[model samples]
Target chain A: MMTLIVLGTLLYSQYRKTTSDKLKGSGNVPYYLIALLAIGMAVGDDSGMTMILPSRGLLIWFDPILEKLIE
Target chain B: MQTLRISSNQIAMLTGCFLSAGMIVSTSKEMVYQAGQDAWTGYFFPMVYGALIIVISIWLYKGREGITLFELNKKLLGGIGGSLLNLVLFWYLLSMLITDLRKLAEFVKTTLLLNTPVSVTMFMILLLTVYLTRGGIEVIARVGHLYFFLLAATIVSLPILLINEFSLANVRPVMANGLEALAKSSFMAVGSYGEVIAMISVMFAFSYQKNPKGLHPMLRGVVFGTFLLTVLSVTLIGTVGTSISARAMYPNLMLVQSIHITDFLDRLDIILVSFWVPSYIIKICLNYYVLTECISSIPSEKQNPKAYTIVLVPLVFMMGHLSFESVVELVHFETHVWSFVTVFLQVVLFSVLIVARLMRDRQRKKEVELT
Candidate 1:
């Protein structure tokens, strides 16, 4: 996808531009976190993403239970 | 570093407009639906609640001039702790941005640009937001000030324009379902109206004209927003009656549709749609700036703030597209999921920050005296 390519380039550029300490210290975790989140959202149901966080299999079981509670 | 400064009035307009703009179309309908005829009460609850949030947030930053909540997070929580919190804040703001874009896209698709794809509409708005934000917050604040009157006039004049249709009987049995229903609706209102918490990002961006009276122009601006929202709710319920307004997706848009104006001016919903554009853009830009600022807190990111917007555009587009099954799902998410999380962040997280700041200050004072 265009987004993946763009993001890959940005990440590579960012990775090359800054040191590991700066990246870690500057709070670059969100870049990876958000990249994964976008992929999960785009893949839809199969991504098994929960509404709350970006973990792959973490809350997949919980969402259905929450839905049942709403019902 | 060259710091940008906007007046307190600009801050007030920017924050006030950001908070109130989309309520008429998106959130107020749910409140009316939940509380029946008494939904006007929902407006008052969040007004008081939001004002308190502003007070506490401002007080927390009172002596700590030039510091943002993001910096406070770094100081109190340390690098890793703060980065993790920043991730949480990113999720919060990003989720909001996606939702707002979806709502705006929905409005555009339904009312104005019927043939346009929702993704296209959303992309268009985000494109504008990126442009606004690249100018930095000052430009956005100035734009909010410039168009504040146009936005306010369009919103306030709607109820007045449709005064002929209101029925006093509509809101008659005000607390018919009693306090419990009202309380439920108020809780939901926190998600929609109490988003003033987002303004804390821009709090330090404001340069006060005078040496600070307690929350002066900012509080007034917030009160004005609340007043507009309350009036909007009252007008919708009074005119369309509670049951009809409750069921309507956009009660205010419906109100605009009801106006004949003249034979020539009948399709005034188009013009009303124009009002939402600036206000919604202001809101989106504010949130986007906050998210970007949080992201930029990473040392590598400090070099390129606007670069992230390029990456965010497709992510936002996809999230807005894929997040909900329908408008029903969107409303359900807003009431059930988003409301509680937002309140928790505003109240509980803010309290933690205040306590942490106090302890930090005490330790600093002790060291000063020791020296």
Candidate 2:
């Protein structure tokens, strides 16, 4: 909860600054979205909800093959 | 918005600290396990590989003043191809950052804060990393310069302080493992040392007063770092012997715990850890800085570096949590998978870029000659 609040505040300020500066290109929407997704996943993981999959499972397939070749 | 620049000496110090800091804690045991008492000999491979990386980096930096590796890729490989390479590099660097964060957090949890949650330790470290990174590379370099001296002083004193514990016979029977086993052990160390290639991303920031010394300063830094690691490997094996050093989780920490100088000077591991934590933080800060630099240069419609840095904090936090389930898994991934990926990027991919640059240079030279 505290992590969300801090990140939310940061994202909001960034959004404000991006708009107030009237940057030439797109706004901070994409960054905000990414941050929100990441924070959600982090919160979920901390809460034992498994919002994100551990990368080890994804990369573990290659380990045995590489280990043999390296050996 | 202002351009940031750091002196060659500063970058050298930063590279030294960046390369040697974490290896002392996490990697020595693996090397000892692989090569037995001949672990110190394994550093020779990384020393050579690291020199090759520095040479190639200097070669790429020539004729391209003030341009970063991302920009150089775009220039040499065109838009789509360059961005693809950048994304690949980004993924690799992100993995590096995640691993470093987890490794440091785990070390702290095991050593100092046994009761503290890994998440809290990681969060605190990332908070510091983000704060230091926001100050830009110059700030990171300055902090590295200060910590580098302290790290060197502490590392240099390890042998002297632990002299009583030394057993010269412990490191004997060195080549009993044969040359093939020694070669295999050296291959693992290459990935750790190849991390010096991270300097390529920030090579644009190096400010040379006269004719640039090419790879001299960086190579010297790497050689010095390798020397320090060699001293550490020798000390760890010499004092603790191969069996204990290999079996211990962090042999360097164990070696430090044995520092009983006249019974008064004990618990030196605490002092060592105090100096070590900052150096590890600097390493993480550099990785974070490079990752952000890569992201900001991805030729996006919205190229906001600061926004990306802010957003990346939570993402890194999340990934750090989701990367590895345990230290054993992390070590396995590092040895088998991460080492190959890093070596491929630094050795194979950079070789491709070097060849492309050479071909382009030849074509330009021929056209000029025709004109």
Candidate 3:
């Protein structure tokens, strides 16, 4: 983790110095989505935490609604 | 900025690699578990469905000519609506990447590195993926193209090698469980094949070529990859018996394990696995590349692909490790939520976008006529 932080810092500094001006200014949502989802999936585990995503939580919330609509 | 270019054949090969990597072990078992011996029949339905969806997706993409999905969404739905849609698509891809990494890590831990930590295996994979992503898409595509023949050879030869073990009785009495069960199982396959939608991210990467090859190689890649997956599932059911194939986590590997070149040359599963590793890593690299492209599209993040790689690769590794307490929960989510996510993102969202695009075009045409 420490290694990554240092590497990230160095790389970002280098990036800022050289090619920062050329950076494209679109596609933020895709990155945000990937970051958010990756974090969500990462924190998921069997700690009985509300992680693991749209699996149990989604099913529990959705199944009843779906069943009601179907009926 | 000069963009790197690859031909249509390379695009097909990359698509084929990404499509087949995750399917080898998991997809067959799920279909067999759901549809029983009729799993093969169930698989056929989705392959067709996915093929049609792929054709439509390509049409939508080609119609726009080099526009990214992110740009298309923004154009079609204004800023916030497009951003929301992009978020949905992002979740779909991220979840898939996590799932694939976890599956691969679990397989490696169980089969190859029993004593090694799964995190280590996953981290190793992410490192390689990051390394490849740093090379940019051209390098990745060329590597995929080179390995495409080897991967194809493996897929084609595996069943032929195991032909002696196959039995008509294993897959006999198909649809004894009724068409309803078969159809239900077919729905599951959409999640697997529907991932062909991920091709959209890189579609713009192919736009500059205007390869006269048309969509033939792309379509061929989709069809051929789906065909390989279908054959793999059916062959596993035939060779391993439906019950065992359904229950076993890695029935395809099990089939390979059963291969015996000679008494002294047994235990060939590991070699088969080594051949599969490149294909699997190619898929991971494609996802990582897409992730990188996504990040680089943001002006602030675009300058240093290296920084993003250094940061996001670790996040991906950690995500795979922490995503589930056990493979069971992961598989459970995969079986249930994954298919819905793929369909919603790939089929439902794309279909709506196509319709909206058509409507907008029609409105423009009507106004032009009035003028």
Candidate 4:
């Protein structure tokens, strides 16, 4: 609803600014809806998951090779 | 749309910005890595082939001085003839834009919004691209033009993050892979430059007439863009070794993350994220604007580009969403299918257009001489 309201306001304002190209509710519907859906889906998905931290031994092994290399 | 028509220097900036497309830099890294310390050689050999690809594409562009492949098709083939060909180009570009969006989403998820939902991050980027696309091409280029400082800052700070990790020895045994490896790596670089063919459409939106000087700046921008990609490839291979760098995902970012950077800035990669997000903005908007211009060439949409953009915004969002199911699928398509399309469509189509234009030019010249 808030998204819709915001869209309405923006459309109304755009219509006012251009005057000739008046606010067609249809103007930004697809754009805004796509945005809203992407947000809903992305935010709603797993937020707590984390990539597994590499093993200590792996990091240690990497450290020596990388130490000489990165240093 | 109007913004797409930019000064040559502006196009130069875009030349650099568009390199953010994962196909060129990221895929090459993987191909090089997959192919090992031997990767660069594989890449280099291909450049000879890739240069053929670039030459074919650039020659096509050169065939016509100002017009691009899109318009050339219409002129040469007439209605259905040209539209059918360009539809392929559109699909090719749209596919790239979708995957590129995924890259942006993944980058945000891994770096800044680790805790944020992937969809939301994707949404944020879509919102920006749509808004900018609707804002017009000139605005997109202007924003791209304005972003150089941030882009440069990120590139410049890279050495600081990986300073500890780089080794001259890591890059030793340069020709260890023989000619084959070097050749392959260079072809991959050709794909990288090939992606810039989208710029021609952007050129049509902006006025290049009074200022033919635009070519010099545009070429310079491309040189700079190419230099940036080369430095990144060489640096990543040197620091991580072709072996590890090839295997690692986002080797560029990992090059940053792996560093402690004196502990306080334990993760400076986040700072660079600011630049990364916006770089995609420049790219996606440019893509959206080009798509819009292409669609508008249809008689109706020419009258009101707004309707097309409104319709295009979600279509693009959905296209981006639908193109990749998982990272594996996303990256896979990007590396193989996407690379070929990026190369062939831009290169081949333009080659056709260029030949057509040159023939036309000669006819005009001969007619003048005869008269």
Candidate 5:
């Protein structure tokens, strides 16, 4: 439901020509692409697909190494 | 960026509110755990570190009165280098936003909305943050100015309200943990205080306001924020003792829960939470605003701020959801990893900018001599 609302808003804003010059010249491609990717990941996670990589795992891979250094 | 202007006072208020909100609830427990009874004293080193950050930021701002750190990077480092540095900043700001949203969601889930999912809480907060960000910095600062007083009053009243529970004995034997313990605790505390660097991103917004003193308002705000956090640190350890506070998830919340003025006036945590929620939201909004600003400033082409806000909402929501497995992990990452990252990035950024500025000055001087 929330995803639909965000998608609807993005679509409606683009349809209304409210996007700025940069977005319009790019045909709102990047915005839609990001929206799709984010929505897909969110939906995949909701379905117990284990597709959404946890941000900590992605960002803090060096934590164990850094922890040892700090210790 | 929009040409709207806000006073230095508003900036100070926003900074103070942001710093205090970020530090008060989240860090007290860890400070206690690391510094033992002397946790309140640990802020001394952070105080010095925060002052250096502010002074360097002010010096940087003085060199380029109306330009943002993003634009400064572009001017000093050139195209590719500037974009690379901006990318690092974007990552840092986004990570901070994700962590804050997760922390707030965790707090709401554990304290207020026991049945609500963390995603719902994060989504709701992001919705409000998006709304505020779209309104731009003026609206955010106005809201900050209004709420600053209320936050100040609530924080000030904590010690008085909890006087009965406060045991000076808990904070006694000052510095008994030795300078080593205090130094280690101060290192932990520095991460939160180091957030004073966030002011640099928006210093450009202050260009329209004429202040002869120049950035003193920001320094004042940092001092005010540090003062409030110091009071909170002392109050928490005094009220609950080091053992109980270190064990509790939210030590400040625990302190508030102990407030018992009278039977009718008891259970003030709900009221206190209501006041605190807005301050925390202000912090989130400021961070979100800065992140969007960094992005908008990156592309040579002008970008729509509203579009970025809307597009990033789902991404932020997902990241917030996936950031930490539990509060313990979140706290561990922040204290151990995030601190080093912020301090290192800030130091490198400032040093490079200052060095570049000096070299530019020297080159210009040599050109003048040739002429």
Candidate 6:
């Protein structure tokens, strides 16, 4: 479920090119939103960090799909 | 008169300092007891993986064009989605900073300043970091350079200190843990080396050479950083047996504590820690820069440090307090979860984007030819 959400955000960022930066929102709510979300992940389940470290062989294979998607 | 500043050399020094980030805390005999005598070899694979990462990063930003990861995130992701991705990236930077602070405070309390609250240590360090972050990237670079000289002076004396304990047999027996240990060690190392991922943010904000060609300096910096990390790992495994090395938090500290040049040279851990502070300073600057840049890059956004830093201070403080556990917990999580996400996101994710972008470009070229 969480992967889906994170993947969605990643995909969306690729297409939208729109970011919620200090210059965007008036209240600075988005700033904290981003900070808390990121730190939360750092402190989140270590096991959940699987999206980053696949086995070496797996990384080599995942390379192709990643290229297609990000491009 | 304009003040003299740090050049690429200084930045390289800072990188050397951080290369030991989890090493000190995680290489403890206890922390790495899982790997037994093979822990040093285990650390070697990660350095190899990290070297690969550095090569790719330099390739991606070939011109020293200063294209930040956040900006690249946008260019690759696009307007709205890219912006949001930057936000997520921003927080990732924050979380790392907090984790570093937590580690520093823990080391201080356990080894020195026994009565000092973690908050006091963290706040003091972070306040210095905040001041440095606002001092501009050049100043950050300059300060890092100065510390590099100091770091060099201290690190060079390692052999002198550990000369008594030197033994070749301790690291004997090639492939002691079998192939599996090598594989797992590489995996653990992937995350450690991945800490260099923090560079993308700073590289982006760096002064451009009109193109990214000068990135060789950064790449060279990474090579130097890895070399130092390799030495630290080997010496650590040497001075302390693999079992003890893995279990001791800040194994390097233990290594330092064990070293004795003269009877008068006993308490040099303080000297090592003093030399260590600059690397943390540069590292803190890097983290804060990433956080600030991510927030500032919000489309149509202008940053006011007062509004941002004020809130950031306490939030970071809270994270430190909340995560006051043994180095083992930190290492367990870092090697497990942190390692996974960092490798996936930094390496796997980028590789994916490059492939996608290239294939798409090729497809478009084909369509143009057909037309």
TM-score for every candidate vs. truth?
Answer: 0.87, 0.91, 0.85, 0.75, 0.91, 0.76
Clashes of each: 2, 0, 1, 38, 0, 54
The numbered model that scores best in lDDT is 2
What is the C-alpha lDDT profile of model 2 across B1-371, one tens digit per residue? 67778888887787788879958777778778888999899989878888887777777777786867877888888877787788778777888888899999999999999999897899899989989998888899899999999898888999999999999999998688988878877877777887776776875544554236555667778888888888888999999999988888888899889999976678878988899999989999999988877776665442645556666777787778777888887777666676677787776679779888998899999999999
Give the per-residue lDDT of model 6 (tens digit) for B63-84: 3344666666566656676677
Task: List candidate 2 segments past 4 Å from native.
Answer: A1-13, A16-33, A36-40, A43-58, A69-71, B209-211, B300-304
How do the residues B307-347 of candidate 5 rate in per-residue lDDT, one tens digit apiece?
Answer: 57766777677667766778887877667667777788888
How big is the positional error of residue B165 in model 1, measured in Å on the Cα after superposition?
1.4
- Alpha-carbon runs more than 4 Å astray in model 4: A1-71, B1-5, B20-25, B38-69, B204-215, B298-303, B362-371
Q: Write the per-residue lDDT of candidate 1 for residues A1-71, one digit (tens) a residue.
A: 53564366456546654543334443455556666766666555324343543221212333345345433
In terms of docking quality, how is candidate 1 classified? acceptable
lDDT of 1 at B63: 66
Per-residue lDDT of candidate 1, residues B1-371 (tens digit): 56778887887787678767857666777777778888888767777787887777667776666756676677776766666676577778877887787888888888888999887787789889988987987888888887777878876897777877878899888789788768767766777665776677656645655345666666777788877777777878888888878788878888778777678988887787787778888888888887777676654334345546555665666677667657776666666567766787677677777787788889999999999
Candidate number of the best DockQ:
2
Output the better candidate (4/5) by TM-score.
5
List model 6 lDDT by residue over A1-71, tens digit each.
Answer: 33343344434432333343323354356544544543454456243432332222233344345434322
Better model by lDDT: candidate 1 vs candidate 6: 1
Model 3 spans with C-alpha error above 4 angstroms: A1-71, B207-215, B296-307
What DockQ number belongs to candidate 2? 0.39
Model 3, B156-241: lDDT tens digits are 88777877888889888867988877876777667777776666666654544643454556677777787777777777788888
Determine which window of 10 residues in candidate 2 chain A has minimal summed lDDT: A49-58
Listing candidates in order, what is each one's chain A TM-score? 0.33, 0.41, 0.35, 0.29, 0.49, 0.29
**If both were scored by TM-score, which would come out higher, candidate 1 or candidate 4?**
1
Between candidates 3 and 6, the one scoring higher on DockQ is: 3
Better of 3 and 5 by lDDT: 5
For model 5 chain B, the run of ten residues with the poorest summed lDDT = B203-212
